[model samples]
Target: MIGVNDILSPGMIVAHPDRPDWGDGQVQSSIGSRITVNFREAGKQVIDGDRVALQLLSAD
Candidate 1:
């Protein structure tokens, strides 16, 4: 498990496998075991529904 400090904040890029094409995203919220991500798609930032019950990708 990774601490909140381990994960970067909003505007920070992250890797999300669910969005393989867009592979990068800006953090929106981190709560419990889930992290909300907003990915840039077609020149627009949209909420990615890949947040629920996800594992942290941080190196502990």
Candidate 2:
């Protein structure tokens, strides 16, 4: 099944569902279930899309 992360592309804005302190993040790259994001407050983070469902903030 296609998950939300599966549709996420680079440049899309997102937020960590569990780490609100990480603040908003921009999708740098997404490969399979691995997603690399640069957070506003936490810097770069490689999130496991299979484990975390990042909330979509903006597609543009």
The candidate maximizing lDDT is 2
C-alpha positional error of residue 33 in candidate 2 after TM-score superposition, expressed in Å: 0.4
Regions more than 4 Å wrong, model 1: 1-6, 42-60
Per-residue CA lDDT of candidate 1, range 30-53, in tens? 544455666555233344334422
Q: CA lDDT, every prediction?
A: 0.49, 0.95
Q: Write the per-residue lDDT of candidate 2 for residues 1-60, one digit (tens) a residue.
A: 777799999999999999999999999999989999999999999999999999999999
- For model 1 the local lDDT of residue 7 reads 56
- Indicate the TM-score of model 1: 0.46
| Span of 10 residues, lowest total lDDT, candidate 1 | 51-60
lDDT of 2: 0.95
Model 1 residue 46 CA deviation (Å) reads: 11
